[model samples]
Target: MRKFAMYGKFKAHPGKGEALAEILLEAAEQCKSVEGCDLYIINVSEDDPDTIWVTELWNDLEAHDASLRNEDAIAMIQRAKPLIAGVEPIKLKPLGGKGF
Candidate 1:
């Protein structure tokens, strides 16, 4: 099966950047144990403190979907909704990469 990749950009509510980042970081750690989760990285934008990005690579679409059903992951997502002002997800078809 082909791997799945997603690049997500999150904008935090005014003055809520740090809080949003903390939640995302914790969620990333929790996701590390999920099956088929190849990579889950959290990044903060230096240019815009309120902008956060998550780069994820999964073994397949099923694995990525299953991760969302996790209790901890579900909880984290709910908690983050209030702090997030906006979110955008960009799907990627990774042909080749050093990390892979």
Candidate 2:
């Protein structure tokens, strides 16, 4: 079965990118331990200090759906809630190996 990937881009509070990145790093690690989580990573923008990108790959849709019910998943979102200005989450259905 093909996997699914989620890409998230969020604008955090001014001057709080590093702090938020620290928090997100923990969250990403937390997500990695989840059952269906293939990978989770936090990427910071070089030019923009307030922007961050999160990449998540799930084994399947069921696992991705179940993640919403997991405590750590809930906590991750909650932890990021206060620090974010806006969140844009995009779900991707893998067509092949690479996606631009």
Candidate 3:
């Protein structure tokens, strides 16, 4: 089956980047207990302190979609919403990689 992946950037409001990243990290931990979740990574760059990058890998598109509706996931989203200024998401089809 083809894996589903998403590379997204979350722009935090003003100086809320670190706070937003922390929330996302919590979400990453929550994903560990979710079925079909392969990876959920939170990243930051010194060059962009107000931006948080997230990488997610799922068993398939359906699994990814279901995860969005997961209770923990929904709570995390709510917590992060106030800090988020904008979001940019890039969908990808995983072919091959070290993590794959």
Q: Give all candidate RMSDs, comma-separated.
A: 0.9, 2.5, 1.0
**TM-scores for the candidates:** 0.95, 0.82, 0.94
Off by over 4 Å in 2: 98-100
lDDT of 3 by residue, 1-100 (tens): 7899999899999999999999999888888888899999999866889989899899999999988888888888999999999999999999987988
Q: For each predicted model, how many residue pairs clash, with residues at least 3 apart or on different chains?
A: 0, 0, 0
Clashes of 1: 0
Looking at model 1, report the run of 10 residues with the lowest lDDT sum. Answer: 91-100
Tens-place lDDT digits, model 2, residues 26-91:
877677668878777899988898999888788888887887887876877788788889888998
Query: Between prediction 2 and prediction 3, which has the larger TM-score?
Result: 3
Candidate 2, run of 10 with poorest lDDT: 91-100
TM-score of 1: 0.95
> Clash pairs of candidate 1?
none
Off by over 4 Å in 1: none
Worst 10 residues of 3 by lDDT: 67-76
Q: Which is the winner by lDDT between candidate 1 and candidate 2?
A: 1
